[model samples]
Target: MPDKFDTSLPPFDCLSDSQQQRLRDALDVAYFRAGETIIEADEACQQLYIIIKGSVEERAADGQEIFAHYTADDLFDVRAQLDARSRHHYQALEDTLCYLLPREHFIALYQSNSQFAAYFDGNLAQRQQLLDEAHQQQNLAEFILTKISDDNIQPCLIVPHDTNLTAVTQAMRDKRVDAALVKLNATPQYGIVTRTNLLHAVLLDSLPASTPVSQVATTPVISVNKGDFLFNAMLAMTRHKVKRVQVLDGDNVAGMLDLTQVLSLFSTHSHVLTLRIARAKTIDELALAAGSQHRLVETLFNNGIHTLFVMELIATVNEQIIEKAFQLVVPPEMHDRCCLIVMGSEGRGEQILKTDQDNALILQDGIDWPGCAQVMARLTQTLHQLGYPLCPGKVMVNNPQWVKPQSEWLHTLSDFVQAGTENAVMALAILADSHAVAGNRALLSPLQTHLHQLLADQELLLATFTRPALQFSVPLTLFGKLKTGKEGLDIKRGGIFPIVHGIRALALEHAIADNNTFARIDQLTRCRVLEPETASNLSEALKLFIKLRLRQQLGQQQDPQSRGMQQHLDISVLSRAERDLLRHSLHVVKKFKEWLGYHYQIRD
Candidate 1:
């Protein structure tokens, strides 16, 4: 219906003639001279412009420009059609004739023509996201100063260099900050303090409080200039995991940037809970902190942070929260008698999202527990409240079957290795990945020690573990094509799990205790357990798999009906790029499976 010269839009052959006629009738042609303003930045964009002739330049006020040259039916201002607040100014570069479809007309055409609407909906959604990011950047620019300036900040908690440990401790208590700056010459230099330093100096070393603060003060203080953005300061704190930062105005000490302040500025309520759990004294506070786990995972994933980092950071936080919870709930007398162990993905530090509780406990011999069962029940219940669902198979710490003494767990592993049944192998797979989340780390160490001993029998290890690694065949046939079925292969079973399981098998064979998937891959590569090419392929496959899952999880958040269906993420929502990555990843997985089959010499 509308054309100028060479450029042609994507074919609308699927649409009925009536739908095409509707779109044609709605389009309004307009002309602009060179240097004419098509749209202004920050203004509401009420119409979509498709250039029928000539070219235009889109520029931000800050001098960043993008050229959008079109001829004969090329979409120009699709972003304006989607986002009400267009962040860039559009100007004609030459004599331009364009068709303007007003919002009402566009929507009418969209409703009447399903195919036409689908084209706009998908592209418009992406363009709107870009606009929202631009808007966020603008907002961030406005808050830059307020975020940096230590206005409304508390004074730097200080103790004299000569002050006794007792005085320094009192100052820390009084200030409520974990650390105090030891001001030596009134000008800040070469003095620092923290709870960790206090614990090491006073408790572990049995030093007296009257001991000079200089003895405990960490020198070469990590300080940030006042002119720096709060984000930089937050990064510094996050990197160091320090509770306080010295705020400086050039050379002069201005104030202190406490973790609380930074957390308050950049974090949500759930993030605040993480800090609270770190400092929590009672079980109640720890439980409350644990409750925020689901929200924390959702927020972190949604914010576009690196998924691997998010998983590791979340796992770290989870371990801290779990430790604190145990400290709060478990009686002090039993602390030495028991150990809390995390199993499965939790232990591997690859918990991309919250799922069920997979934990176990190892109690010391000669420990009586009339209250132990009740305690575990309460613990699991608390975990359930904190967004972890109870293990459907009753694999949690609450189960008496899973909770046992160190000798018992070792014997169980020995039995599993000897029997080498499917169930026993599965149990071994889960136990092989176990890491101590709380309580006695020694209890879990024995399991690793025994596994290393068992792995010495290479034939048995391969027979038991390597079989599961080839359970799911990778879907190479789906490559470069849209997966039409509602049920694509479970990505976890088809791709992620096999790689993870295969890597675990290799790690066990090598006696590698590294639970991280990436770490395991690296370790295997270094030890010549796996070829460099295979390791690289596995790494890329894992990355692409996690990225796809995360993208799906994020998309689910936008759909109200699918809020809780994150585990059953829709693969159809994946972009063409994502689908390609997935296909390539699966091909790599298939290659890895073939390698495993040959190396393990499995007849199946």
Candidate 2:
């Protein structure tokens, strides 16, 4: 043990008196000249160092360096000591002295103090994350190679009992001189001999290579479906300890799935869906394939895919589902006669989760039969069966009030716009987001034109419609801390709905036709209806609100009792960071509300 270790270092300040003295007695002071290499990359570390005075340059294996300057108190080599792997190079940049603590002794010291142990544990975790990123960059090919589908490869190289060796050998040579799959029928059911098997047959067993490939062919094939994700394929490969997996289309073998080739695709959800859609034959098949929408959303969220791109992808999938459903249900003659219009969130293309159906039909005026209502009723029922629930307020195809002829829709919009009553204003606000989902899209154009013409006079509509956006206040009290208790802040009322309504109000004022939240925000910003910073904040707030709602819906899906109650659970589960973000978002909504209240001259 060395005597007189310096306790002036900042890290040593946290230690208790007895602990400090123990560390001081055990530490060995080492001196290093400037430009000396303290630690070499890929060399194991056996000790921790507390900097007495020094600066070091840390470099990667590729020679990229970062200057890590340390004064009299900083700790260095903690990661090296914890990981026990020398994956980084550290060189002294200045003349320095450090107190070295052997790894075993320092670990023993940590075992006695929970706080000290936690501090090191946190540092170790951060270091591991950095190391993992570095390793991922270096060994990308190996990472890809591990993800090959299991279904493409056979379990063993064996042919059927009756097949001749000459045919098997010829088949193997034709397929690039390795192995051939043997099966009783046309489908691959077993595996046959390779070059290694031929050698074993001729040398070890004294049997000729031409004796019978079937005699040497292995039995049973290792297989996996094409739908399996890359990570799942990698896991299967690791578990089975096999290099190749056979790819199956359904019940039949489609092709060989080499681990190396499958891993190269980086098989994203969009890529998978594209492949699935390309091969799809009928409307019913497309509808079935659209079931992967939820997985696609989850994947996009996990992979940090762009928020706008995510919305666009979801919108495309929703359109495909609706289009396919309509194709399956509607008569070919009626297809040209009627149009499907989506309203509310679906029309806005901001729907992140499956919600209630809000749609209507716009049919041509000349073809109204008594059976039109029944046809629409069946269509609504089919949509409900496809996971979209009926709107509790009857804002769907089943509602005769919502479905009407193009001429009737125009007349209704003209009346509502001219009336300008509170009810008319409310109706117009909902109708503003109406978009064509299928059929004659031209039918919606006239209604949009009429609505915009009416909205040109902002004073009348702003006074009545704009008040809803300012209905809820941010839950901040006099002291500036968030007000919370038994029930959490109503995120929808206080944060999300307000921002959405405010943005929509601006869009309407400018006659900006874009309905998606992000797109509308961009349009509003460009028209000088909103500041750029405000638009960005509102977009972020909407994303957080949507994410929270999706999580709540997923939770409700897991529990039968919770399904009926659409409310999210208590907010205690949110991390400190999440709560902070929520507060910041709500503050933004509050500012927008104040702006709306002032602009509309509302007394409340």
Candidate 3:
């Protein structure tokens, strides 16, 4: 029967109806008792097995080690089927039932279906890319990816600089638009006059109707290119606090994009959310704005924006929120005397959801600000109020140890390098990713330069710094089965931290300046520290890990009682594609860890 076999799994799912029918027609159910060897080493493999029930293990030739385990819904022996021989012995872990697709029919289908063939033939990165492409096709939202063009822009109502407010108002009304473009006669610059500008000019200032609109128009009109993302246009409008933004095609004015139009497509009001953060005059106002960030993140993700883009955008928002809080607490006179820094994930700009605060402050040498500690503590409290969780290690601005003058900061780093203890090395590693968020950012440069110089050629310290990356196992069985826990899988510990820290360690060794993992990987590849193929796989693996963790984090947030389940990915609930991806990504992680161990010469 056609329904007897399921064609829903990937690779097979990609096959055509006729091809699937032929496969089903050739399919046969086979059984193996426990302790039986299904295929012997060097045997000529005649069929590809799709496990229908129970479990099987592919062992090394001597049967001393297992390569992989296959359970129900898992397929096996693709390599053997393609090569026409088994390199290893396959044994039934339990009484096993499997669907057998004979080799000749499988080869005919593999030779015919390029898409199906690519999955088995491609590397890890390429396989994940194939899955991502399929996922995007099924889930990508069109509106968020919309580009600015004439189709969405309103016709510009252009008027001369000398045009009277009354005439401009009438022109705007006739054009059925709320804003007019004032082309200055004296210069090539264009100014914008909105209905609010007209009303203020007449009602608030008591200007005569005959007054030139140019007097009230805002010069150097805010604009976005016609080729820019519609989402960016929305950001511009929010960041600038304008209802309409001028659209330009190169140097020429294209038209205008009204707030209402963008809101029509993006009902999330992300512009309004950003505007609230931008204009927050008090900590309470800022906190209210911060509360909406998670919702915005969910909306953007649900709209199918890439996670990297989301991280970059969210990092910008987070920095702004922090900078605003700092300015509110620290006196204006002290602003230039010190720089506020964020370390760890915040420093690297990979954080998508709000996590613990990992901030520090770097002071200008000999700045007399006795109240600095109190001000920093207030800033930290303000951030906490705004939804940033406190760092468990107290690695924040409020900690006296993290706040220091430039000269003292250099000394502290030198001391850390000299001490070379595990804790000190870890501290140095965290500071390696420091990014200045506010104030005299220059204060951090000399300190960073000193830290790098001290670390230069310090192989022992670097190895010790890298040693922690191997602290946690990859949570996969030797035979490629997922290793779970009471709280499911701790993806951050198992997958994300190793990749992030391993990349960080290599970056430090190569003296690469970028803090973001993806950027560091690119630089490492460019410097030949990492092979291009290895870099590509690491990048893909890290992306998958972060995306999966974010999914679980969002799920945890939705269920408050599950807050204790943070960062633990429940494997039982994963989709087939996600499970496949997770398993493949973990294998990449395992290999990278081995590479790190070899590079650092650290044995387990």
Error of 3 at 53 (Å): 2.1
Misplaced by over 4 Å in model 3 are: 1-4, 16-26, 133-140, 144-265, 558-561
Question: 171-213, model 2: which lDDT tens digit per residue?
Answer: 5666564655666454546564567776677789887545756
lDDT of each: 0.70, 0.67, 0.85
Each model's TM-score?
Answer: 0.62, 0.56, 0.83
> Residue 455 in candidate 3 has what lDDT?
77
Show pairs that collide, candidate 3. Answer: none
Ranking by TM-score: 3, 1, 2
Indicate whether candidate 1 or candidate 2 has the larger TM-score.
1
Best-to-worst ranking by lDDT: 3, 1, 2
- Assess candidate 3 and give its lDDT: 0.85
Evaluated against the true structure, the overall lDDT of model 1 is 0.70
Candidate 1: clashing pairs of residues:
165-209, 166-209
